[model samples]
Target chain A: MHSDLVASVRRFNRTVTQRVGALDDEYMARGRPLAQARLLWEIGPDGAEVAAVRARLGLDSGYLSRLLRNLENDGLVTVGPDDQLGGDGRVRVAALTESGRAEWTELDKRSDELAWSILEPLTAQRRQRLTSAMAEVERLLVASMVVIEPCSPNDPRARACLRAYARDVARRFDDGFDPALSTPVRDEQLIPPAGVFLLATLNSEPVGCGAVKLHPGTPAEIKRVWVADTVRGLGVGRRMLGELEEYAAERGWTAIRLDTNRNLTEAIAMYRSAGYREIERYNTEHYAHHWFEKRLRPPRTSGSRGHSDN
Target chain B: MHSDLVASVRRFNRTVTQRVGALDDEYMARGRPLAQARLLWEIGPDGAEVAAVRARLGLDSGYLSRLLRNLENDGLVTVGPDDQLGGDGRVRVAALTESGRAEWTELDKRSDELAWSILEPLTAQRRQRLTSAMAEVERLLVASMVVIEPCSPNDPRARACLRAYARDVARRFDDGFDPALSTPVRDEQLIPPAGVFLLATLNSEPVGCGAVKLHPGTPAEIKRVWVADTVRGLGVGRRMLGELEEYAAERGWTAIRLDTNRNLTEAIAMYRSAGYREIERYNTEHYAHHWFEKRLRPPRTSGSRGHSDN
Candidate 1:
C-alpha cells in the first residue's frame, strides 16, 4: 500500500471511529451499554437461539453464552426451549421481557439521534462530505477485508452468498442463470489439495467471495467470484479474483479459466479490465459460451500480496 | 398506478417480508416489533428528536409517543432531556437502554439475513434486477416525497442543505464559491408572499431543496436551488426549478432568470436541458457573469403545488 493513501485511510478511520464512537467501552447507549442492549434486542419478545445469535454476531460462543446468562439473570430475558438451537428437545432459547422491548425502543431512539447528530454539525456541504466519506469508507473497508477460504458446499453462509450471486446473475444475464446448466461446486472438490473458496467480509459482514478448483489434468477453473453491490467499486471482485489466482498458483496451476454471459456487462468489463483474455469456447459447459483465461504469474518470492489492478 | 406494477411491488414486498421474516411477531430476538426494529436501526446509537423521528418515520405524534413510552417503560430509552436537539431548546429527546443496543445489534443481523435471503432465491441476473429496482425505488420515492414549501431564510436544515450545495458547486466550479461574492438568498425574497422554496425528501430524510423569489423590477429570480449529492440525477433539481417557475408565473412574472458560474457543468447542463436560453447578462449580481432566462406559460388558477417540468 502507498504510504500516503494508507495514511489517509488511517486518518479517515480514526475520524469515523471517533465520530461514530466506535471505540466506546460499551456500544449500547448513554444509559446502558450496547452489548446488553443488543442481547435484549436479539432476545426480542419471544426468544432466540444462543448459537444463532453467536453466528449472526460473529461473537465468540462462550462470550455470547455469558451475555445470555447476564440477560437471563436480569429477568429481562428468559431462558426457555427451542428445538433447533440444541440437538436435544430441551434448548435454552432466550426471550426478552416486556421491559426489555421498551428498553430497546429507547435505545433505538438514542442511536438515531447519534447518527443524525453526526450529520448535524456539518452544513449540508459537510453532511454531503460526511455521507460521501462514509460511503467511501464502507467500500474500502469491505474491499480490504475479503478473505478467500475453501469450504464444503453445504456451508450455510457460503451457500447463501453464492445463491445470492446466482440470483444476481439471473437478473443480469439475457437468458438468466440456470443452476442445472452450470457444474455444481462439489463439497469434496472444495477441500484443500483439491480446491478452495474465499469469502469477503467487512465490519464482520460477508460481502463477497470466489472459488477455484484443482483440476486433475486441466487448468483450475475459477467460479462464483462476486462482490455485494454495496461494496462493488471498492475492488472486492478484483481482490477475490486475485486471491483465487494466488491459491491456484500455489497449487502449481499456471492458468485459470472462467465463463460468463453477455448480460454481465460489468463483470465482463471487470474481467476484461483485469487482463482476462477472451478464449475461443474453452468450455462446452451448457451455460457457458463466453470463456476467459488468465495466466497466473508465479507467487511473489517476497510473499507480499501483489498489487495490480488486473 | 398500473395494477400489475402495483401488484408486483406488493408481491415483492410480501415475498421479501415473508422470506426475511422482517415482521415476524415471534422471532422474539428483541422486544421491539419490526417497525421498531427498523426505526432503531435508522436512529442508530445516538438519539433523535420526537419531531424528526415523526417526520422520518411519517408517524403520528400520538403513536410515536406511545412507542417511546413503551421503550422508556422498559428502560430502553428516555425522552425530553435537554434542548440539545437544535439551536432551539424546545425539542424532545429519545435515548436508548442498555438492552436496546443489544437489540439493535440483533436487528442489524436480522436485516443482513433478510437482505441475503432476498437475493438467495434468484439467479445472478435477478439479483442485478433487484439491485436496479431498489436503486430506482430509492430515487423515485425520494423524488416523490419532496415537499415544496415556503421557508424562512434561516431554517437550519434548509440552510445546511443549501450550504452543502454551495460548497459542491464551488469545488466543481472553476472559480469556486466565495461566500463574500456569491449572491446570498435574502429573507425577503424566499419568505412567502414573494416566493417559495421546495425541499426534497426520501423516507423523510431531507435530500435536496430549491427556492424562487420574485424580484420586484427584474424577471423572477431563482435562488438557493440545491440538491444533495446523495440524490443527484433524481430529477429533483428539475422539479424544484419547474415549481419555482410556476410560482413566478403565478405572481405575474413573465420570465424567470438565474445566474450561475461557468464551471458548474451539471447545473449548466440542467439549465440548457430545461429550455433556459442564455442571453445578454441580466443583473449586476457580484458572482454572476453569465445569466440565463426562460419564458413560462401562465400558471394554474388554483395553486396545487406543481411546476412545469415540461
Candidate 2:
C-alpha cells in the first residue's frame, strides 16, 4: 500500500472526527452523552424491539439493557411486552413516552443544527460539492466493509441473495426472467471441485452473490453476479467478479466467460471495463443477448500470510 | 440549509468515524492511545519544539506537557532544551530515542496496514475511486473549515497572504506582476465605511484574501481576490468571491466587478461559472485583459447568527 494514501485516509479521519464531535463525551449539548443520545435516536418515535435495537447497533445485550434502564429512569421511555407488532407476547419493546417524544424532537432539532453548522459557513456551491463528495465517500466506505466470502450455494443467506437477484431481474427484463427456463447451475454444480459460490454481505446481511464453474480442459464460466440495490454504486458487482476470477485462477483455470441480457446495460459496461471482451454467443439461453470473455493471470502469493480475508 | 444534505453529511460522519476506528481507545493496535501516537507522528523524524506541537494539535499547554512526560517515562522520547533550531535557549524540543525510532516504525507500519486493509478487499479500480474520492472529500472538508473574516488591510497575516498572492501572480504573469505598478487600493481604502478586506484562514493560518472597495454611485469593485494554490481546487476562490459580495451587500451595494489577466484561465472560468459576465474593460491596469461583473442577492436572514467568521 502507498504510504501517502494511508496518510490521506488518516487525515480524513482526524478532520471528520473533530468536525462531527465524535470526540465529545457530550454531543450537541443534549445534557446526556453521545452514546445515550444515539440510543434515544435509535429507539426513535415509534420505538423498537429490544432485540432489534441490540442487533441494529451491534451493542452488548447487557449494555443495551443498562442504557434502556437509564432512559426509563429518566422518564424518557417505557419498556414492556409488546404484542401490537405481532412479536411473541413475552418479547419486550421500548417506546418513547409523551415527554420522551418532546425530548426526541429537541434532540433531532439539535442534530440538524449540528449538521448545518458544518455547512452553513460554506458557499452554496461548496456545500453542494461537499455533500455530493460525502455521498460518494459514504458509498465507497460502505462498500469497503462489505465482506465477500466463499459460501455453500445452499446456505440460507446465499440462496436468499440469489432469490433477491432473481426477483430484481424478473421485474427489469422485458420477457420477465425465470430461473426454470434459464441455464441451470444447481447446488451440486456450485459446490467445490465443480465450482464455487461467493456471497457478499454488509453487517452480516447477505446482499450479493456470484458463482464460477470450472472446466477441466476448457475455459471456466462465470454466472449469477448481482449486488443489492442498496449497495449498487458501491462497486460490489465488480468486486464479486474479481473474487470469482480469483477462485477460478486458484483452481488452475486461466480463462472465464459470462453471458448477459442487453437490458442489463450497466452490467455490460462493467464487464467491458473489467477487461471482458464481447464474443460470439456460446449458448442458446433465451435471455442472453451478449456474451463476453476474459483471460486471467495466476493468483498472487505473499511471502507472509497477510490478512487477505475478513 | 437543505435538510437532506445535512442528513447526508451526518450519515457520512457516522460511517467514516466507525470505519476509521476513531471511536476506539486503541488505534491500529498501537499500545499507547491515539493522542500519544499522534504526538509521536507529529514530533516526526527531525523533532519539533514543544510549542509547535501544542499549536498544531490545539492541545492545552498543561495537557501537552503531561502527554510528553508520559512518553518520556516510557523511554520512547526525550524532551529538553534545544538552541540549534533557533528558539530561545530554554525552549524545549522533543526527539525520538533509538527505541522510540523502532516504536515509531512499528506505529507507521501498522498504520499502513490498517489503511491497506480498507483497500485490499477492493478491486484495483474500486480502490482508485475510493482514494480519489477521499482526496476530494478531504479537500472540501478543509475548505469548509476555512473561516473568512473581515480584517484590517494592514494586519500582518492579511498582508502576508497578499504578499504570497503577489509573488504567485508575478511568477505566472507574462510581463510579471508588481503591486507598485498595478492600481492600488491602499490601507485607508479597505478600512470599513469605505470598504472591507476579508482574510481566509485555515486553523488560524491566513491562506487567502480579498478586498472590496465600495463605490457610492457605481458598482463596488472586488480587488486582490486570491487563494493559496494548496486550497485552489477546494472551492476557496468561489467562497472568497461570495464573501466579498456579501461584504459589499451588507453596506448596501448590490453589484460587483473585477478584472484579471488572461493567463489566469482558471480564474476566468470560475468567474464565468459564478455568474460574472464579460463586460468591456473597466480599467487600464497593466495586466488587465478581461473584466467581469455580477449582481448580488440580498443577504440571507436567519434569526440565529451563523459562524461565518472565525
Candidate 3:
C-alpha cells in the first residue's frame, strides 16, 4: 500500500484549499481575470517594467506577459517603450491608461470583496489559522522551491540579499556599518578556488546567499551569509551554512570559523547546534565584530560540495 | 556591524539555548558524557541494535562502538547480546542495566527542566512569538533540509508526517476522513519516474512531504501533502507543491491537477492563490475527492522563477 502521509496531506490540502477558496474562478474575475486585474493595479503612475510587474505579482514571466497582453488588448493598458523609466532597449514598460486605472481601482475593490467573502465564513481563530498557515506554507514552499545555485560573486540577487543583510547589520550594530569598514575579506578573494558564492532561491527566485573563503592554511572563513527579508524564518541561512561547513569538511579542513557582530543570536545557536564550539577571537575580518570557531568533525563518507557562508 | 535580525536571532537563540541548556557539557551529561548518556537511553528495558544506534545518530560505527564502550565502562549499561529485531545481521541490540534506568530518569528530569526553562521566559506574546518563530524556523529549516533521496515508499518519517496531516484533516472535516475510502491514488503509484515525494526538514529533521503522481495516462494527480505539527505554519506544503509542480513540468507533463475532499479549506485556498482553477469533476480514482487543475505555463527559462497559484 502507499504511505499514510499522501492521504493526510491530500486531505489537509483539500480542506485548506477549500477554506482558502479552491472554487472561486471569479475572484478578481468580476470582468477581468485575476492576473490581469493585479497587473493593472501594479502598473505605476509613470510606467512599470515587464520584469517589475512580474516581480510584484510573483507570476511566471511568460504568464505575466500574457496577462499584460490581455490587458493591453482590452485597451485598458499600454505596453511599449521602457525609455521613460530610462531602461535600455531590452526592457519593455507597461502602464495603465486612465481607463485602465479606473478599471483597476474597481477591480481592486472587487478583489477586496473576494478576500472578504472567503474570510467571512471562518471564525476569527480559523481565520488566523488560515492566514498563518497560508503564510507559513507560502514561505516554506518558497524557501524549499528555491534552489541554491552557484552564482557569480556579483550576481544581483546575491548582492541584493547581502545589501539587505548589511543594511540590517548596520541598523543593529552599536557602531553602524560602513560598507567600507564592515565589508571584510577582499572581494577578489571570495571568487572561486579561494571560495564560492551561493544564491538561495525560493519558488526559483533568489532570496538569499552565502560565501566562504578557503585560504591555503587557516580554517575556511565564512562570509557574506545572509537570508532575504521575505525568507527570514525559512532556514535558508542555516542550509547555506551547513553546505559551507560540509564543503569545507570535504576539503579535509579540520575546522570552520565565522564571526558576527554580537547582535546575531541565531547564527550563534546554529553554529552551536552543528557541533561548533565557541572559541576565542581568531580572525581580523573587519566586518566580523564577533568571532566564533568550531572544530569541524571529519566529513561523512558521503562526499559533498558547494557553498556560501556570508 | 551585524544585522539586527542576526543579532536578535542570536540573542533569542542564546536566551533559549541557555534556558534549554542546549550547550551545557553536562546538559545531557546525566552523570555521563553525552555519548554514554545517549547509549544508556537508547538501550532501553528492551535491547536495541548497534547498527540501529549508529544509524539513528548518524554516528560512525566506530564512534558508536566507543560510546557503547563508555557506557559499559561506566557499568551503567551493557551491549552483551545481539538480540535481532529483524532477520538481518545488522540488527544487533543493546540493553540497559539497573543503574542505567536510574541515570535515564535523572536525564529525563534535566531534559524536562531544560524545556521548561526555555519555555518559562517572557509574556504569552513572546512565548507565542518564540514558538511561532521556532515553528516557522523549524518548518523552513526542515523543508529546506529534507533529503528527497529515494526510499522504497514506506519510509517512516514520510508516513508519520502524512498520518499527522490526515489526522488533522479528519478532525477538521465536517465528516471524518475514511482513509480506506478516501484515497484517490494508491501507494505503489507514488514511486518515482511516475511520481515524486518530497519531505520537508528543519535542523535536518523531517517535518513535511508531498507527492505528485502521474495518473498513468490521465493528468498527473497531486496527492498527500503533509507538514509536521512542529512545522505546520512554515509554509512547507506550498514548497512541496512548487517543487512537485516544477518536477512535473520537467517530466513533460501539462495541466497538473489534484482532488481533495470538501473539508480541506486551506488546501483549496492554497490552490487558488497559486493560480489553480476549478473545473468540473475530473477523476474519481478510488477516493474520488473534489478536483481542481491549473494550465501549465511554458518551460521555465534559466532565470529565477516565481510562485504558484496554490
Candidate 4:
C-alpha cells in the first residue's frame, strides 16, 4: 500500500527483467520467441502430456496450441495421442523431434551461460551475497505469489493438497496417521454455508490448503492447515492461517481452534507466534497431541462477508 | 561459489522472469515487444540523446538503432539532430510525436497496473513483506551487477567518478574540500606501471571509483575511494577497497594506506570494518582528519597480476 514500496517493486521489476534478458525476442539467441523456446524446454526429450505442459506453464489452451503448432511446423516437435497408458486418444502429448532435442539442449546450455553471465562480473564474495539475497527474494516472491481462496473441497487441486497433507502427517506423526482411524471430514462440511475450504496455489498448481467448519452455536473450528515442503517456512502456512481466521471472523465467528500432533513442532510454533494460545483438547481426534485457539475480532464494517475470489 | 547458491539464483531468474511477463511479445498487451516499450519509456516525452538512451539501456548501437527505426516507422517517434543547443548535426536525439506521447502515457499506466497485479492478490500485510523483500533483492542485485575493473583515470567515465567524488567530499568536509590545497593525483600515476584506477559501473554507467598509487618504496596509497550515493550502502565501497588491495598485493605491494575526511563517517566505518587500522598522519592533505593503513596479504600463486578485463 505504501507508494515507496510500490515504486521499489517497479524498480525491481525493471532491473530483474533486464538482467534476465526477458525482453529479448530470441531468447538465448535460439532464433525463436522465448515462449516457444520455453515450451520446447518444458516438453523436453521424454515429451509431456499436452495438458501437463499447459498446466505447468500456466498457458491457456489456445495460446499453447498455437505455440505447439509453430514448433510442429518448424519440424521440431510432434503432437500425438499419449500411448504410454493404453493410448487415451483424447489426451494428447507433445514430444520434441530430433532437431527439437538439439534445440532444447542448446537452450539448456544457454540458460546456464546466462546465469553465469550474471555471476561472472561479480567477485566470488559478491556472487555469494547476490545468490543468497536472490534466494531470499525468490522465497518471498513465491510467498506473495501464492493465492489463497475459497474452493470446492472436492476440486481436483483441493483434493491434491488434502492428499499431500495426509501423506505428510502420516510420515511425521509418532504413530503414522490413518485417515480411517482419525475423525473424518466430509466434503459437504467444507463447502460454503456450513464452512469453507481454502486452497493455496502457485501458478495454478496447488501447494497448500486449510479449511474451517462453521458449526452452529459453537466457535468455528479450523482444520487441515498444511503447506507443502516446497513452500514451507516462507510463511505460506501463516498466510493460510490468517486467511482462515479472516474468513471465520467475517462470517461472525469470534474464535477458531485446531489440533495438531506434537511431531509437528514447527506448526505448533507457528500457531503460538500467530497468537493462538495453548488450549484444552477440544476434540478427540486420534492423532491430536496439542490443541490451540485464537480469539478473532469481529470483522470491520468495511470488510465484506463471503468469499474473496482471489 | 556454492552450487546451491547458483541453483537458487537460476530458480529466482526463472520465476521472476515469468512473473514479470518479460517473455511476452506484447508487453502489457500494448501490441509492441517489451524492448520497444522499454526504449520508448526510456526516451520519455521530452526526448533524450540517442547516445544517452543507448548507454542507459546498455543496448548495442545496431540494436538500439533498429528499435529507434521501428518506432520511427510506426510514426510514434522522430529521430533527428538537436536544434535547441545550437544544433550539433552529429548529435542526434529521439523525441516522441503526439501519438508517441499518448502511447507513452498508456505504457506508463500499464506499468502501474502490472505492478499492482503482483500485489492485488495478497493481504496488505503480505504486500508489505513482499515489497520489503523486493527492495532488498534489488539492492543486493545492483551490488552484484556492478563491475569493477581497472580503467585509465583519464577516461571520461573515470573522470566522471572523480568529479562526483570531489563534489561529494566538498559537501561533507567540515571546512569544505578544495582540490587546490590537497595532494593532486596525476592521471599517469593512476594509469598503471605507476598504479591503477578501478572504475565501478552498474550497467555501463560509472557509479564509483578508487585509485591506488604505487609509490617507489612506501605503501601503495589509495585515493578517491568513493561510491555514488545511489550504490553507497550496498557494499560497493567495500568491494572497491578489496579490489584496490588485491591490485596492489598482486604487484608485490605488501600494504595500502589512505587519508580521509572525518565527516565521511560511513567511509571511515567501512574502512575500519574492512580491517583498516588508525595510523599516524601520513600526509598533510588540507581536509583530512583521519589516516588509515591496511596490511595486504600476498596474492596467491594462482592469482594473476596486472588487470582483469571485466
Candidate 5:
C-alpha cells in the first residue's frame, strides 16, 4: 500500500480506461453500451445458463432479467427454460438469435480491430513485449481472484476440482495415472481429524484443489496439489502449499511430505522453493520420481507474520 | 494482428475495465460524472486556460463550456478572463476554489484507495508482479499512441521536445550535455535537403524527437535520437530509428550512423539490436564512446507488408 504503488496502479487505470474507451457511451464502435455488449458476449457461441450468467457477472437476478428483456426486445437474444429446449427444463438459459450471432461477430471483429489499433503503432518487438506483459497481467489478476477455502471432499465443486486434476495428470503422466492405482483417500479420510480438502475458486468456480492427510505417528502427507493451467504462474501452487502447511500445523503436525512424478517439473520446483527438502523415497508409489519433506513449526497465532516467501 | 494477440489484448481490456470500475455509473464515490471529474483533475493546482483545457481533453468548446458552467454552479470553481483576473483578458482561465481543492484532494485520496483495493486481495509477490506489469503496459500504451511525423526543426513543439531531450541527457551524462558543445546542426541544417526532424507525439503532445543529417557522399548521421521516459520502453526509439533510416533512404542515403555516450546503455543496446554495428569512433565529440553504423536496404514500398506484426 505504498503511495508509489497506488500511484502506478491508478495511472494504469487512467491510461487503460481511456485507451479502451470504457468511459465512452458507445463501445467498440457498437451502438449499445458496454454492459449490453458484455452480456451479448457472455451469451457466447454456445449460450449459457441464465443463472450462471448472473452469478458470473455478480448481477442481481432482477437486473439480469431486465437486461435480457432488453436484448430480447431488440431481437438479438432469447431466454427460455432449459428443459423445454432439451436441457434440464428447469434452469433458464440465454442464447443469441441469428441476428444476435451476427451482431456478436461484428462486435468481436471490431474488438479485435481495436486491439490491433493498440498494437499497430509499435514495432514487431514491442508488440510481442506488450502482449506477453498483458498475458502475465491477466494471469496474476485471475490468480488474485482465486479464493482458497476448505470444502468437504464430497462437495460437488470440490469433487469436480479433484476429478479435473486427476484427468489432467492422467493425460500428462507417462504411464497414465488412475485414481484406482494411486493411494486412495475416501471422503471420510478427507474430513477433519483424518484430512482436509482445500478448493481454489475464481469468481466462485472451483479451479484447483489440494488435500492433506494427518497421521498419528508419522509425518502428514500432502496430496492432490493441482492448479488450472489458466491460473498458473499466479503463485496459486505456492499459496495452496502454504495454506495446507498451516492446516497441518493447526492439527499439531510438525512434519509434512509429498511425492510427485518427475514429469511435473513445475510442481517439483514449487515444492523445492517452498522449503521442502528432497528426501529418499519413503513410499512405494509406482510413478513417484521425487519425494520432498519439510519441517513445520507450530502454527503462528499472529496472522500477519505467517506469509513467508515461497 | 494474430487472433491470439488480439484475444489477449481484449481480455486485458476486459479485466482492467472491470477491476477499475470504469464502467460504473459513479467513480471513486464521486458524485459527478467521469468527464467532470477528469476536467477537475486537468484544471490541476495552478489552473489552466479554458482553451488549453479544451484542447487537452479534445473537448468541443460548447461541451467544455457546459462542463465548466456545471462546476461553477456547484461553487467548486471560478472562471474569469485572464486580463480581469491578472493580465491579458483575451483568454479565459479556470481555477478551483477552496472547497474545490478539498474535494479534489478527497477524490485523489479515494482514487488511490480504489487502486489499493485492487492490490489488497493479492499477496505481496503477486502485487509486485501486477504493479510491474502495469508499468510495462502503461509504457507500451503510451508508445502506441505516439505518432512520428516530419516537422520543421524550428517548430515550437519540435524544439520543445529537443530541449527536453537535451535537459534529460544533461542530467544523465557524466560531463553533462551542452547543445553548444555538441556537433551543432543549424536550423537550416535540419530542414529538408540537408536533414529532417521527426517529432514523436502522443495525443498532440510532443514526447520525443530525432533528426538525421544527410550528406552527399557519406552515410547519413542520426542525431538527437531521444524518447521521453514516459514512452521509452514502447520501442519508440527503434521505430524512430527505422523511420529515420527510411527518411534517409528516400533521399538516396543508403547507410546511417550515430554516436552515443557510454552512460546511455539502453540506447546503445537498442542500436545494437536494431542491426547497428559498432565501429571505431567516427565522431570527435568528447562524450561519444560508441559509434554505430548500419547499412540500410531500399525502403520497402508496400504499406500492407510493412506492418507485419499488427
Candidate 6:
C-alpha cells in the first residue's frame, strides 16, 4: 500500500465531494438538507419499500425513520403498511403525496442541471475527456465496492445470480443452455465441508457468483462463475474467480478446474491470464467447449485469509 | 454533447458521493454535521481569514458566520479581529481551540481510514488501477472546474496570476526574466474596449491568465498566457488561448499572435497544436526566442458567446 496512492484517493474524495455540491445546506436550493433531499429523491413518485430504501441508502433504521417522519410532518410523504401490495401487512412503504411528486420532478430537473454545470465550464473535447475519465473511475470504484463472501447456494441472492447466469448462457450458447443436461449441483454440496459458494454483491444486491466443490479424491471443481452486465469488464468476474480459487486452495485442495462454453470468450481469456491452462476433458458437461485448470499454492497458514496484506 | 456522456457523469456523481460518505449527517462519526466538521478541519490549528475560509469552502457569508457561531458555542473555535497581525480590526479570523485541534486531528485520521477502506477490499493490482483512474478523474475534474472570464487586470486575483507567471518565467527563461526588460502591459490597455484580460480561477483562486490587446490597425497581441503549475497540462492554457482568441475575433480582430521564450517548450508545443504557426520576429522582447501567430474565425453572431451550444 503506497502512501501516495492513498493520498491521491484522499485528494480525489475531497475534490469530487465539493464539485458535486455534497456540502450544500439546501441542495439545488430546494430548501432541504442534502441527506433529506436525497432521501426524498430516492423515495420517488412510485414509492418504495421501507427496508429497500433504507438498504439502498445504507442508512440506519432510526435515521431513515426520522427523515421519513420529517417528510410526513411536512405533508409531503406518507409511511404506512404496504397493504396495497396484498402481501406483508407489517412491511412498510413510503409514498409521495401530490406535492412530493412535484418536488421529485423538480429535483430530477435540478439533477440534470447539476450534471450540466460540471460540463458547461469545459470545451467539447475536455467535456468528453472528463466524462470518459469519470466513467473509468466510477467503474473501478464499483468494482472495489463489490463484496464477495461465502454464501449458501440456497440463498435468494445466490439463486438470482444462478438464474441470471443460466439466462445469459442460454442467450449466447449455440445449442442453448439447459440445466437438466448439465451435471446436477446439489445445494448441500456447496455448503461448508463439501464446498463453498462465493456471492459477489454491491450494496448487498448480488451481482456475481462462483462456486468450488471439494470432492475427497479430486482437484476442486469450479463452477457457475458469472458477473452481472452492470459490472462486466470492471474485473468483478476476475475477482470472483480469484476468491473461488482461494476458497479451495485454503481448504487443502491443490488445484481447481472449470469448464466453459466457446461463447464465453471473455471468461476463457480471463482464465488464461489468471494462469489457468487448457487441459484434457475434465467433465462431459453438455455445454462445455473447453476445460481449463490451474494449480494453487498451499495457504500460507491454516485458516489464513489470502491477500490480507493488500 | 452525447446523452450517454451526461448520463455517465450523473452516475459518477451519485456513486462517488455515496462512496465518499458525503450524505452522512455526522461524517466519520464525529457527532457534528459534515459541513461543520469540514469547516473545523479547514480552519486548522493555525487559523484562517474568515473571508478566505468562506471563499475556499464556497459558502455564503451568512451561512459561514452561522457555522462559525456554532463552533464558537461549542468552544471548539474562536472568531476575532486580526489586531495581533497589525491588520484591519474589522477583518476576522477563525482559529481552532484546543478541543477543535484535537477534533481536526481525529477527522484527519478518519479521512485516511476512509480512503484505506475503499482500497482495502480490492486486490493489490486492482488497488493500483483504481488509484490511477482516480488520479485521472481528479485531474480532469480540476481542469473542468477552472472558470475563465474577463477580469480587470488590476484585480487582486489577476495580479496574483501575473506574479506567479513572472516567478515561473524567471525560473525557466535562459537569461532569467526581468519585468523591466519585457514589453510592458498597462491596466487600462487590458480593460474593455482597449483590450481584455482573462483570469482563470478554480473556486475563486486564480490559477492562470491571458490578455489580448485589440490594437486598432494591427493583429491582436496576446500576452502573459500562463497557467499555474498545479493545473498545468490539464488544458487550462489551451482554453485560455481559445478564449483570448475568441475575445479578439469577436471584437473584430482577424488574427492573434504572441512571443514566447524558447525554454517554454510545452507552451510552444501547445501553440503549434492550437493552430499557431511560427512567424518572423514580432517584437524586441529581451528574452523571446520564438513568435507565433494564428488567424481567428469571426464570431457566429454579434455579441455571441461562442461554444454555448455545448
User: Which candidate has the top score in DockQ?
Assistant: 6
Q: RMSD of model 4, in Å?
A: 5.9
Candidate 5 per-residue lDDT, tens place, A1-310, comes to 3788888888888777677654322444377866787888889877899988888777888888889999999999999888454568678989999999999898777777778888888767777889989887777777776789999988999878888888888988998997778767678777887888999998788888999988677888898898988787777888899899988887777899999999998898889988999999999887788999999888767554322322
Instruction: Indicate the docking level reached by candidate 1.
Output: incorrect
Q: Go through the candidates in order and give each one's DockQ.
A: 0.02, 0.37, 0.01, 0.34, 0.44, 0.51
Better of 3 and 6 by TM-score: 6
Q: Model 1, range A1-310, lDDT digits (tens) per residue?
A: 2333323332322232222333221335445556776667655565777666776666787888788788767767777667563366645677677777677676555545444543433334434443443333333323334454555556777777888898898887667778887767776676677888778765446688788889878999988888888777656677688778888987788999999777677888889987899998876666665899999887767666423311
> Chain B of candidate 4 versus the native chain B: what TM-score?
0.91
lDDT of each: 0.64, 0.82, 0.63, 0.83, 0.83, 0.85
Q: What is candidate 2's lDDT per residue for B55-150, written digit by digit as tens?
A: 988899998999999989998899989858665987799999888888878776766667777777776666677778887777777877888899
For each model in turn, which proportion of the native inter-chain contacts is also found?
0.00, 0.60, 0.00, 0.51, 0.70, 0.69
Clashes of each: 67, 0, 68, 0, 4, 0
Q: Can you list the residue pairs that collide in candidate 4?
A: none
The DockQ value obtained for model 1 is 0.02
Native A-B contact fraction in model 6: 0.69
In the order shown, what is each candidate's alpha-carbon RMSD?
15.0, 6.3, 23.3, 5.9, 7.1, 5.1
> lDDT tens string, model 3, B81-199?
55545566545567777877777777665655443443332234433444454443333333333344334357887777677877887887776778776644556777887687777
Ranking by TM-score: 6, 2, 4, 5, 1, 3
Q: Who is ahead in TM-score, 3 or 4?
A: 4
Clashing residue pairs for model 5: A83-A89, B83-B87, B83-B88, B83-B89
- Top of the candidates by TM-score: 6
lDDT value, residue B62 of candidate 4: 97
TM-score of 3: 0.45
Error of 1 at A135 (Å): 2.8
Docking class of 2: acceptable
Candidate 2 clashes between residue pairs 3 or more apart in a chain or in different chains: none
| TM-score list, all predictions | 0.46, 0.75, 0.45, 0.73, 0.68, 0.80
- iRMSD in angstroms, per model: 14.3, 2.7, 15.4, 3.4, 2.0, 2.0
